[model samples]
Target chain A: MESIRLFCPATVANISCGFDVLGLCLDTIGDEMTITKTAQKGIQITRITGADLPLDVTQNVAGIAAQAFLEQLGTDQGFAIEIHKKIKAGSGIGSSAASAAGAVFGLNALCGNPFTNKELISFAMKGEALASGCEHADNVAPALLGGFTLIRGYEPLDVIALPVPSELYVTVIHPQIALKTAEMRAVLAPEIPLKNAIAQWGNLGGFIAGLYTEDYNLMQRSLSDKIVEPVRSPFIPGFDKIKETALQNGALGAGISGSGPSIFTLNKGIKTAKKVAFAIAENYTETGIPFEVYTSPINKSGVRIINR
Target chain B: MESIRLFCPATVANISCGFDVLGLCLDTIGDEMTITKTAQKGIQITRITGADLPLDVTQNVAGIAAQAFLEQLGTDQGFAIEIHKKIKAGSGIGSSAASAAGAVFGLNALCGNPFTNKELISFAMKGEALASGCEHADNVAPALLGGFTLIRGYEPLDVIALPVPSELYVTVIHPQIALKTAEMRAVLAPEIPLKNAIAQWGNLGGFIAGLYTEDYNLMQRSLSDKIVEPVRSPFIPGFDKIKETALQNGALGAGISGSGPSIFTLNKGIKTAKKVAFAIAENYTETGIPFEVYTSPINKSGVRIINR
Candidate 1:
C-alpha cells in the first residue's frame, strides 16, 4: 500500500490505582494519522491539525515514532504524514500515546506491516521517551493493543491484553487545564508505606480477577486505590468531590485519569454512565474553566487502519 | 452426623512474589484432622501425631480453630479432634493453615456446613492468627478453597479462587529445620523503596492476569519475590543453591514457600517437576539438614471429607 490512514484511540492510563502499569483503551476520542510514501528519502510531517503539536519530525511524537519504525526496517523510503489529532496533547488521556502508537501503526501498514505488535510498541515507546522524560508504555500499550492492558515490565516489553467485561463503559472528564506528565509525577512521594503497597497489590490482584470472572462487586471493591489517588488528587481541581459524586451516582470506581486535569469513572451501564457524566461535570461549576465529559464503552478494538 | 474426617492440603503462601496475598494448594502434602461429636459440649484434642503440637483447645491451632467454629454455631455439644498432621509446623508449608483449616472443615461438615466457604475462611483465619501471630489467609484461603487463590484483602475477608493451569505441577522441598514465622517476619524491612514496590505491583498484576488467561510464560516471569525472598532467604540454609539448582534443572520459578526452612518450585509437567526435585535435593547434601521433596499436581480440591 502506498498510503494508509489509521485511527489510534485515546486511552486512560493508571486507571485510578495502578500507577505506571495499568491502562484501558477508549472508543469515543482519538487521533488520526495518514502516512504516504514519497520520493523524499526521510520521514516528514506534512501537516498537523486539531492541536498545536510540533511539525518537526524530531519533536513530534508521531514523527519520532514513524522515524524509528522506518529506521528499524532499514528503509530510506521517505514518507509524509498528516496528523489530525482529536485527542489533545497534555490532556492526560494518553494523548501522546495516540500520536505515537498511531504513527507506528500507520507507517507499519504503509510499509507492508513488517513489525509485530510488540515491535510496534517498542517504536512507539521511543516517541513517549521524547515527549516525556521517561520511556513508558502504560498508555502506548493499550493504545496499540486495545482494551485493557498491563505493562508487566518495561525492560523486556511485556504487554498483556487483559479480558474486558462486556458490560462496562468508561466515563471521562477532561478539564481545560493542562497538567504535564512530568509535573504530575513530581508530586508523588518518593516512597509509600508498606501497608499501602500491600493494599495496592491486593486490589490489583482482585481487580484483574474481577475482569476475568466478570464480578462487578469484586471489581467495585478492588477499585479503591491506596497509593496514588490521595496524594495526586489535590493537584486536580475538584477531583475528590467529582470522584465522590460519580461513585455516589453509581460509578464502579473513579479516579484521576493518567496525570490528572482529567478524571474517569467506570460504570456498568450507559444510563449510569450518563448520570456519572452529569454529576462529574457539576463539580467544575465554580471554576468557570471548560471541561468535556465523554461517555464510551470500553473500546474492544484499539487502533485500526481506516483508509488505504 | 456425629463424626467427620477431613484432609486439608499443604499450601504455598506468597507463591513466589505476592507476599501476604497469593497462595496455592498441593495434592500430595497437607494435614489430616478427624473430629467426633461429644455430648459434654466443649472442644477438645483427643490425639495428635506427625509433629508435637499443643493439645489444649485454646493453645493448639486445630483446637483453637475448632473452638471458634463450635462457638460460632452456638452449640453446647463438645468435639474431639485427632490431628494426624502431615504438613510440618514452622516449615513454611502452611502447616498452621492445614491444622486450622482442617479443624474447621471437619467441624463444619459434622455440623452440616452451616457456613459458606467465605465464612469458613474467616473462621480458619482465627486459627492461623493464634498460630502465627498474624491474621493472614494467603495459605488458609487455598487450603480451604483449593487450587490457586488470591487474598485480595484480609480486611472484610476478600478471598478469591483463581484458575490454575492444568499442566502446572508443584515441587516442594521442606528442610527439617524449625524457623519461627514471627522471627522470619521481623527480619523484613519495615518499609521498601518505592521503586521495588512498583516492580512488585507490576509483577503481581501480571501474575494474576496470567492465571486467568492461562499464559504460562507470563506467570513464570512473575514468580520472583523482589521484596521478601532477598531479605529472608539468608535465614534458610542452602536456600539460594536450592533455588538456583531448581531453575537450572528446568523449574519455572523458585522461592521461599511462606517464611522459610522450605522452598518450592513450579514446573510445567511431572517430568520437569521430578528433575527439579532431584536438583533441589542434591543442593542440601553439604548442609546435611534433612529435607523432603514432595511433588504433585496443583490441588484443585482443597480440603475434602473422606468420611462422614
Candidate 2:
C-alpha cells in the first residue's frame, strides 16, 4: 500500500480572552506525520523523528487518536507510522497538537478519506486528552483548519472562522529554557479578582472589535491580560521588559503564548514585524539566552496536504 | 442676545458589558433647551420648564452644566434657560444626560460657540455628576454628539463615534416604571467569579465583532449579560417575556435598557422593528402596563440646533 503524508502547522492556543477556545495556525512551524497502510490486521510499531518521540503507541499522542479512530471505525487494517517532529516538543506551540492532527489527517487520507474535517478534529482532540490529561480542542482545531478560529461552543464542536485583519503579523520568541506545560498550569490562580475580570472583558471586547474593524490602535490599547500573564510571567525571565520593549519598538501588543518560555508579539505591519522580531531577539540576546524568533502572518490556511 | 434652541437626543448608557463606556443617541425623545444670554455677569439659570425642576441652580442638571461651561470660558454670563422635556424623567433613557447635554449645547450656541463638541461633553458630565451623584460620560457623550459613542477614557474624555450599520433599527419600550440608578448600581455584584467574567468577555468580544462585521447572528448570541441582568431583570415586570417575544418577533438582540422598566431591542430592518415593537406592546398589554414604544434608526446626528 502507498504511504500518505500529512503536514500540521504549529498553533498558538489560549489567545488572550479565548482560553481553551481560540487558536491560530502558524505558517512556518509544525510537525509532520506519514502513514503507510500494511497487509497485517493490527497496527505496527513506528519510528519517531526529531526529539525523542513517544513510544508505546497506546500512550503516544498520535497513536492514541489512531486507536480511537480505529475503534470508532471497527477496522482491523493495520498501518506503520513515521513522524517528522519538526517543532520542538512542548515549546508552547501546539507540539502535541501537530502530531495528533497530523496523524488523524494522514490516516483519513490513508483510509480513502472516510471522515469529514469536523470528525477528524474530534478524533484528534481525543489525543489531546491524553497529552493534557483532559479534553481540550484549542490547539487541534486551528492545526486542522487555519486562520483565527473561535470554538464558540464545543459540545458538538462549533468552530467559526473569524475575520483576521490583513495588517496583523505575529512574532513568537521562544527562550531556550524549558517550562513544562503542567508546571505552567499550576501557576495560574484558580480565582481572579472581580475588578480584573471586568477589565479583562473590556479589553477582550475591544480586541474582538479590533479584529472585525481592523482597528490596530484598539488592539494595542486592549491587549492586556490581568488574570493569566501577571501570574505566569514570573516564570519567564524578562517578560515585562520584552513586552515593554516590543511595544515601544513597534509591536501592537505582546504577551506570553500559552504556558511560557515563549513570548509572542503582535505587529501592525511588515516594517513593524521586522522591528518586533529584532527587538525580541535583542531582549533574549541581552539575557544571554538563545531564542528562536518566528515572524509569520496569521496563517489563514491551517492544514495543508503536500502530497497525495 | 437671541435665544438659541437645541434638542439633545436621549441615550442608553452602559450598553451591556460596555458599562460606563458605551451609549447610543436616540431620536423621538430628549430635552429641548433654549438659552439666551443676558448682560448680567454672574451665571444665573433663570428658569426651567420640566416638571419638578430643581430650583437650586447650583445643583440643577441643566443649570450646573451651563455654569460649568461659562466658568471654563472665563466669563459668567447670566442665562435664562427653559427645557421642554419630551423624554420622561427616570425612564432609564438618559433623562439627566438630555438635560445636561442640552444645557451645554444650548449654552455653547448662546456664548457664540466657544467650545468644541468634545469640550461640551466634559461640561455635560460635570452636570451628570451633580444629577446622578457620580461622574460618568456614557450618557453625556452620546447625548452631546448624537451617535453611537464610546467614551474610551474619561480624564481627557476620549470620545469615539462608532460606525453604525445601515440596517439597524432600535425598538425602545418604556414600561412606565422607575428604578433608581443608584439602586440599580447597588444590586450589581461587587465580586464576580472569573469563569462568569470570561463568559462575559467572550460574549462582549463576539458582540463587538458582530457590530463591526454586521453579523446580526453573532450579535444576537453575544448580547447576554451575566452580571447585571440577572439581578436587575427581576425588578421589571414582564422583563423575560418582553425579551423572548421581541427576539421571536425578529429582534437581533434585546436587553433591559440602562437600569429597568425601559427595554430596548435591536432589529435588522423596519419590518422587524415594527414586529418587535408590536410584540413588546402585546407583552405589556397582557401585563396591564401602559407602555410607549419608540421605533427609530440609529441616530448618527445627536444634538441638532433647530431654529437657532
Candidate 3:
C-alpha cells in the first residue's frame, strides 16, 4: 500500500457514572493520522496540523505512539507519520487518544494488522499514560473500536463492547480554555466517599443496562456522577448552567467531557442534538468563552481508515 | 369492599451486586394475604402456613405494616390479616416483604386505596426495617408493583420502574436452610478493594443493561460478581454447584437470591427455565440439601387481589 489515512474519533471517557470504565466514540469530530512506509532504518519527521501541535517527535503524541508501536513490534523499518488534528487539544475530548489510536491503528495496518483491536487499544493507552500520567483505556478503546465500550480490567485489558442505541446523539462543546490533564488529575480526590462510591456503582449499573437494553429512561437516570462531575464542573465556567439548559432544551443528560473545559450532552436525536448544541453555544456566548459546537451521532465504528 | 385477597410475589433484594438498589418480582410463587375490615381497635394476624410467624399486631410483619398504613392515614379502624404463606420463610425469597407488601396493598384496597403505591411501599418498608433493621425497599417495591424496580434514592424514595423484557424467565431454588439477613450483612466487608469495586460496578451496569435490552451475553459476562458473591456464597450450600449447573443448563445468569439458601437463574424460555431448575435440583440432591424449584416469568402485575 502507498499510504493509509486513518481517523480516530473523539471519545467521552467515564461517561458520567462510568468513571474509568465506560466510554463511547462520537462521529464527525476527531484526529486523523496518515502513515507511510519507507525502507529506511529511522522514523521520519511528521506533518502536524490543528492548533499548532508539537513537531518534536518526543513531545508529539502521535510520534510517541509511532515509536512505541515500532518498539513493541521490534521493527527497524522507517515510517513517516503525518498528524492532522481535527479535534482540539485540552478540550476533554480525547484529542491525544485520537492521535494515539490513529497512529497505532494506522501503523498496525501499515505493518500488516499484526495486533487485535484490543492490543492496539492497550498499546495506544501507553501514549495516553505518557500524556496524562495515568493509564486508562476508556478513551483509547472507544476511539479504536467505537460504540459503547467498557474496560473492566486493565491487565490483559478486558474490553467489553456494550450495545449503543441508535437513538443516542452527542452534542459536544469545546470552550477556548485549556485544562491540563495533569492539573485535572491533581484536583480530583484520590479517595471518594463510600456512599458516593455505592451510588456511583448503582448509576453505572443502570447506565450499562441502559446501553445493553437501550432503555432511554434508565440511561437518563443513570447518567449522573457525584464523584468527578461535582468537583470538575466548578472549574468550567457556566458548566452547571449549560448542562441544565441543554437538559431543559432536549438532552437526556450532560456532563464535563472526560476531565473539564469540554462539555457534552447525550441527547435523543438529530433535533435534540441541534438544540443541545445551540444551548451550549448560548451558554458559552454569555460566559464570553469562545466555543465550538459539534452535533454528531454516536459512531459505533472506531479507528478505521477512510483511504488506505 | 368486604374483603380483599392478594398474592404478593417473592422478590430478590440486593440482587447480588446491586445491594439495596435493584429487585425483581416473581410470577409463579408468592404468599397470599387476605385483609378484611373488622370492629377491633388494632390489627390481628392469622398465619395459616409457612414459618412460625408472629401473630401479635405489634410483632407481626403484616400487622406492623397494617399499623403503619393506619397511622399514615390517621385512622385506627382495626383489620383482620390472614396470611396464606406459599413462599416459605428463610427461603432467601423476601417472605417478610411479601407479607408486608401484601398487608399494605391488600389493606389499602380494603380501606378504599388510602394511599398511592409509592406511599404504601414506604409504609411497608418500615415493617421490613423492623424485621431486618435497615430500611430496604428493594423487595417491597417489586413485591407491591411487579417487574424490575430500582430504588434510586430513598429520602422520599425515588422508585424507577425498569423495563422488563418479555423473554426473561426466572428459576428459583429454595434450599431448606436459613441464612439470616444480619449474618449476610456481617459477612460482607465494610470496605472492598478498589479494583473489585470497579468490577462490581461494571457488572452491575452490564446486568442492568441486560435487563432493559435483554442482552443475554452481556448479562452473562456482567453477572460475575467478585465482592458479594465471594464473601457470601460460602454461606449457602451447593451455591457453586447450582450456579455452575444452571449456567451450564442454558441460564443467562444465576446467583444467590437475597441473603441466600435460595439461588435463582435467569433464562431465556420455558425450556431453559425448566433445564435450569432441574440442574439446580440435581446439584442440590448430590449435596443432600432438599430444595424446591419454581420456574416463572417476570410478573408484570404485583400484589393482585386473587380473591375477594
The C-alpha lDDT values of all candidates are: 0.86, 0.78, 0.81
Measured against the true two-chain complex, the DockQ scores of the candidates, in the order shown, are 0.81, 0.35, 0.31
lDDT of 1: 0.86
Compared with the true structure, the alpha-carbon lDDT of candidate 2 equals: 0.78
lDDT of 3 by residue, B116-199 (tens): 887789889888987888878889999987998877766557676777878888999888887888998888676666566777
Candidate 3 per-residue lDDT, tens place, A76-135, comes to: 878888888888888888988998898888888878888887788777877787778877
* Ranking 1 against 3 by TM-score, winner: 1
Best by lDDT: 1
Could you give candidate 2's per-residue lDDT for residues B71-168 as a string of tens digits? 88887567778778788887888888888888888778777788888789888888888867888888888887776776545444556667677888
**Separate clash counts for every candidate:** 4, 2, 5
Model 1 lDDT, residue B291, Cα: 84
Off by over 4 Å in 1: none
Which candidate number has the best TM-score?
1
- Model 3 global lDDT (CA atoms, 0 to 1): 0.81
For residue B247, what is the lDDT in candidate 2?
81
DockQ, cand. 1: 0.81
